[model samples]
Target: MAAIIGHILPLALGVALSSVPIVVMVLILLSPRGRWSSLTYLIGAVIGLLGLTTLFSAIATLLPPAPPEAKSPLIGTIEMLIGVGLLVLAAIRWRRGRRHEHNPAAGTPKWMSKVSSLGPIPSLGLGFILMLRPKNLLFTLAAGVAIGATGATFAEAVVGIAVFVVLGISTIAAPIIFAVADPARMRRPLEGTREWIERNSSTVTTVVLLVLGTVVVGSGLAHY
Candidate 1:
């Protein structure tokens, strides 16, 4: 478990560092019936990420092993492909952001206008959707592949994967944890924080994707 943890922790942490979901979580916290809505969103995020990671890891187990010589390289190939995909996504997002910057109104998600109208169930669904965006899904898949590439034992797989899930949810978790520490004074700050993050989410995500994608590709290449 320790060995597996040593290997995959970076990827897990990388996946967890997304700003958009954290912003969305804070948004939920500021919504109508916010107390439960945010909590439900957090719950939904945890479930979505953990469940998807588990499924991917399980699927990895079912895949036939590559020939010994090709093993590391095969994993590397997959990682590189995922990295390239991420880079492409980053470019696409960057272009969209540029366009949005020029036409600010088009950049707004209609959902934001209706956040105050959300109930617990919708909040939960929104949380799940926010956490499961394509970039996140790919990152989770990359993490799962890294885990499987280790050929981890049962104990190693369980513990290592759990750690990955925890780290992956850290961004959203941190703010909520802090708010829980002082809900009274935190509300206004949380809302302000959310707005700031939302305003910068695209650029942040694009940078994150570019950096992580480069790192993932390098890691994959190093397998050779």
Candidate 2:
């Protein structure tokens, strides 16, 4: 039992960290136009995270064995790619926000709005899709494989993934719940926080992704 627990802990931490992006998405969903019931968000996040894990598992099964020489460079490449992808995403979002500000009529697309309103389910679907992007998926898969190589059993991996999904959803829901439950007290603060996040999220997310990616890539390369 102790051995099993030990093996599981790292995998759980990896999964938990990976779920940060999803948590951010959930927070974005809690906006005035994006409000969703907490239950809806929870359900959506579970479905989405499960789908991502399943897809990753399927792809991993088909992958060629990692060559001894390839492991280090592969990890580094994956990390760098993830960082670049995040930078690109942030840039696009930032530009879009600017455009929206300049032209009130040029709001986010109808389809996107519809998806946001569908609560967590659609968001989960979207998050799964986002994860499937080549760069993102590569980083995520590499991370998973690295964890497995570190002695994580299949059960441990599953538990880790589950914890991550739950925690990610909770992060988003917690703020919304607090705001809604005590609107009179929280209204101003919540609004202020929301505004700050909206204004700074792209910059903050981009910086985080870049730093994390660089560190992961550097570590992987050094290991090689």
Please give the CA lDDT of all the candidate structures. Answer: 0.77, 0.49
The top-ranked prediction according to TM-score is 1
How displaced is residue 219 in candidate 2, in Å?
3.0
Best by lDDT: 1
lDDT by residue for model 1 (22-78), tens: 766776677657777777878888888888888888777765554555446777788
Backbone clashes for every candidate come to 0, 0
RMSD of each: 2.3, 6.0
Model 2 clash number:
0
TM-score of each: 0.89, 0.58
lDDT tens readout by residue for model 2, 144-185: 444333344577656655554455345445655675566467
Superposed model 1: Cα runs more than 4 Å off: 1-3, 64-71
Local distance difference test, candidate 1: 0.77
